[model samples]
Target: MSPGTNVVIALAISSIVIVVISFRNKLVYRQRRELHGCEVPPSLPQLDPVFGLDLILSRFTSLKADRRNVSLLEQFRRHGNTFQSITFGRTTFFTIEPRNLQSVLSTDFLSWGVEPMRLFAFEPFIGKGIMCSDGAFWEHSRALIKPTFARTQIADLHLDDFGVHVERLIDLIPKDGSTFDLQPLFARLALDSSTEFLFGESVQTLAPDLTPSSAESFLEAYDYGQSCVGRRIQLPKFNFLTTDSRFWKSCQTAHEFVDQQIQKALLVTSKQKQDVDGRSRYILAQELLRQTHNLLDIRHQLLNIFLPAHEAIGVAMTNIFFNLARHPRIYTKLRNEILVADLKARTLTFERLKSLKYLQFVINETFRLNPTIGTNTRMALKDTILPTGGGPSGHGTSPILVRKGDSVVFGFYGLHRMPNVFGDDVDVFRPERWEKLRPAHWSYLPFGGGFRVCPGQQLALTEIGYCLVRMVQAFERVENRDPTMEFVEHYKITTESKNGAKVAMVPSHL
Candidate 1:
């Protein structure tokens, strides 16, 4: 009885183990097949390091200068528009040509969807925010928010509010002849402006008695969000488990702050009746809550607006200010234009600011040199062929087959700096180029292009323009304290100045 029972039990256990192992092997094989179908081109001459899995895992999360990324464009210059490789995880098709960009963004936008891995990384913090979401959800969110910025008349209101914020910033500038870090100051200003505009209340981030704890928490959350994305991309298996870990604790802090502010805005909006002019100026949170009774939808929309609204504006402003500090001539030109415009009206108004062509040029130039959103990625939702012109620099006429699920990275930095698009002096800070040549729309996409272009671009431009104008108007002379300030191009979300911009501001004579 013992021998028969023992033999039966042993055989059953072995059979179960075999089935499980076979199933596991099948899953792995399927995944490998899906990956290989993406059809990444053979490694280019320069892709010696990217081919190694160990090297990618080690250096993927590293913030050091990626010569590999940089060289993709250089290879394009030497070889043409299309280059190929598998980096990080998926097969990639990189394009710098305007025609290709237009095709990807405009003509066949649906075919090239947001990259799964990138979206997976971003989902933790931003959730399905309009920036990350696609398809119907994106359409719904965009429809709801589009009207807020669609009116031509709101331009004046935008500028006027921006001026008030700028005045607050000017007051905060130190007159002690002591050098101060402008990065934090610009960051605060951008944050304050975004909060005020989005929620109808200011965090007073730029105030003299800035609340250090709140600022630190905000920054910590932002950095945490950025790091979480990078970490998720590198380690997919541990994503959900690690999302709530200490690395993302600061994200919780940020969420709490955002929720509190949104709640406060809702309360205020609830109390107010539609004004005689139909202008009930309340926080976007309040406006959104009033319109939608659905709790889950409300939460999603709030998160969507808060994440991108706060950081995108901040990053854009930081880049613009960094450029202004580095190129004083551009600053001087911008200031003179503002001063002349301001004097003619006896006061600075939003309408008047639009006439300052040089200001627009400066903003455009900043975008060209240092885009706030540097990289865009897409996943092939279906088997598609991306038409390739040639190798990195080659003019070969060939259409590259991009299988479904392949990841495609559109290098905004590489495309913006392309000599064919921007001319040979692409690296130089020349606002005059905007006057001389009109760039193809996709070539200079700081706010991105096509179906998912940033909804807040107008507001961002207004806020940035106001800040630049006021800073230039208030300071007679501004000089960079750190002339050797290096650009930190490879941060998780934002490109930051490695050394915070230190500047000396001399008061202007009226």
Candidate 2:
């Protein structure tokens, strides 16, 4: 053939290929839409592409400004519970509807996985431990550590340690008619108690005469690194191309301390197996070390547990106390319940502590109002359908389609406080809400839901309850010194007060 003829033939082939690719793209889009019992959820406010992007930016800017994360709650209220928002041309969603959450977290759980962003963000500080891990690694970590949180073990931990730190916490409070920030004090108590539970020795972060102070120790480094993980996530991807030197320094310092502990523990465990019987005992680190010989694995497990155990419990305690201070009637009611319970019981057992109906109700109300976990997120591993929340596009009950790459955030703030779910008084701080109301399935997930629910929840609840009981016993009154204090949470993996929980604790008048 002549060169001209060949050039014409090449143009024809290129056009055909281009047409085929376009057709294929359209086909894939249609297939994804039809997946998981229905097409993808409609954009918030049920808008088209251009309008949806604008809506997305409004929400994004609010978040970027560190304002409310559930900025779409209004949209959800107006339009529907499940809705999508586009960011950088990528679709993400929020599911506040109960059935949708149940599907995502429980029923169809295997269809989704932990969001990659969470893994990437947290792995540096905590490694591939349970909290950020998924699939096989998650299963292994969960299984290995599950037995360590046995009823008796956790009860023993609270019985022996949590009370001591609670006493320290009470002592640390200023009685000079002056206010003090309770966040750091609670953190010290939590750290000391958690360390004692985990490593068989309290770091004694609340100790009176520590020359250097706990703030100057490994706890400081650990806190810095944990918060840095949040910072790193917000930074642009490939941010390490110009990584923060301070972050690395904090990571190094934190890791070095944890590693030292691991090595020391290994040495001690090797020579001394303190098992009275041949069956072995369940101490957090020693038991896990006995199971897995990998130091890094143990470190990650230790850090994952230690960081949340201290930070989350501390945050929860502070917020609870903060709320209680503002509501003295509830505080007095709770204190009365504690005194009543203590008087009636022959001895305070785990069951007895847990059985304080009004006390448990107070804690429940605290969790409902301001969850420390704040939000839970998951990424779809495959095209899937949520069980409900499909009416946005006039496709009621047809099931919302979720594309493989889509992410969903379950915001507890709105979920727990929604009037439809919790009644008209949802926004009010009422411990009595739980008295008459039985929360629907996914509506109450303070510790999360499904197989991946926090294994340490019982332990954490016990610790909180343990502290509160001691606190009520020690003090006749709890009041917020800073009445101007409002609920503003700063987020890492968990949310905490921006400054601190400022409150006044008065000694028992009797």
Candidate 3:
């Protein structure tokens, strides 16, 4: 009796265990399939297999040395646009064609949203400012802040102030042959321009006696914030412990510096209000802080305004100078334009500066060739179809289902350089392309697109333009110290050149 009963009980227990294990396995399989939109082709190879994990790891490690965007563009050419892969711990949807880019940015923008790290990485410093916020919060921030950018003050103040700073920079440069790294010079110019326009204070970053290392703490902290954000994408659990992280330490230093400046600005604005002609130029920061008492919110908006303004202008200026030194004809034409304008006034006024069409052309040309933000990222809010039709890669109109939570990377660098849109001279630094740009709403987005387009575009353009005009007027000859030097791209929020551009400047007789 005991033997028969024992054998039957053991068999029943084993059967139950087998059934439970099978059920658990099925659920796990379903979840993974759902994550990839369930429609991912079975034949589509894993990203690691195509681009070996070792190589991908190496690329990220040597980010400072590699021309990553250019290399990725080359890979897109070889693999074709619309390739599927995973890198930095998320699935990536890369496209180089205009049609595909338009579909992602304009036609089906609502389907995509910002990934977690992309939005929250700067939370320790910026909070949920417009740059990081999505949905309603983003809308509210946009409403409150966009008007400030739209104000005539932004246009008038920025151009005039930037021109003054550029003149100061020129006066400082030695008249005789002296070689210097123009990269840091441009960086300083950008930082000063942005700071003056945003906070009504000048750091005099471009002064000849001013050392770039003075702001090294702030720049390092800024870089740390970007790295932390990128790292968050791969390590979600790290968020809970970020305060103890080195990244957080760097962020704290940046926040403390900003807070001091903000407090100082507030005090000055208060004093200014006491005067009869009482006018405060720190309107952007003042208004933003007054509307929201949240410290993180204030920090976020401040950094949002500061970081992009610094990075985009810095990179664009570097590229412009690089291109000008490389192409003598373009440089000469640009200088001639500045010379003609200088004849009208000792100092270029904001209104007079706008008439320099060639300067604008050169800036636009640099943007096309070297976009500051190499890639645009968005997450799927719900399972939706991408409007992109099949390319040469045969990813046809089968309604590409994007599962909720998957990240879709709209490749801006790839799109900007696409042959179909920009033509055969795609890689060339030709400002003339913009003359024929015509109105292609979503196709060309250096400042991003849709509701999220940069509100600071006008300010950025003004700052860059003023600096360029002043530089041209000041220098009789600008020569590239390292014409053969290649720009190596590294990702830390905005793309930065690994080694700065070195150039020689000589004062003009005019």
- For each candidate in turn, the TM-score is 0.83, 0.88, 0.82
Model 3 backbone overlap count: 2
Alpha-carbon error at 108 in model 1, in Å? Answer: 0.8
lDDT of each: 0.67, 0.73, 0.67
lDDT value for model 3: 0.67
Per-residue lDDT for 81-126 in model 2, tens only?
A: 6667765445677778778788888899888887476677777777
lDDT at position 181, candidate 1: 77
User: Candidate 1: where is the Cα deviation over 4 Å?
Assistant: 1-42, 45-62, 66-72, 87-89, 210-216, 234-244, 269-282, 343-351, 390-394, 483-486
In model 3, where do residues sit more than 4 Å from their true spots? 1-65, 86-91, 207-216, 227-246, 269-282, 343-354, 391-398, 435-439
How does candidate 3 fare on TM-score?
A: 0.82
TM-score head-to-head 1 vs 3, winner: 1
Worst 10 residues of 3 by lDDT: 271-280
Q: Tell me the tens digit of each residue's lDDT in model 3 across 1-510.
A: 699999999999999999899798657655754564444421224456533465456555555455657766866766666666655434556665556566566677777666354655657655677777677877777887787777765565445456767777667666667777777667767767766666657667666676555366776776677766655543444444466577777777788767766776667636223213443344466777667776556666778778777887888888888778767788888888777655432345555566777777788777777788887677777666565533335344333555566666666787777777778888877876666675365667789876778888877776777677767877777787875655666576777665566678877787
RMSD of 2: 4.1
For each of the candidates, the C-alpha root-mean-square deviation to the true structure, in angstroms, is: 5.7, 4.1, 5.4
Error of 2 at 491 (Å): 1.5
Better of 2 and 3 by TM-score: 2
Off by over 4 Å in 2: 1-23, 31-40, 45-66, 70-72, 151-153, 211-215, 234-236, 240-242, 269-282, 343-346, 393-396
Q: Give, for candidate 1, the lowest lDDT window spanning 10 residues.
A: 38-47
Look at candidate 1 and tell me the lDDT of residue 328. Answer: 82
- Top lDDT prediction, candidate number: 2
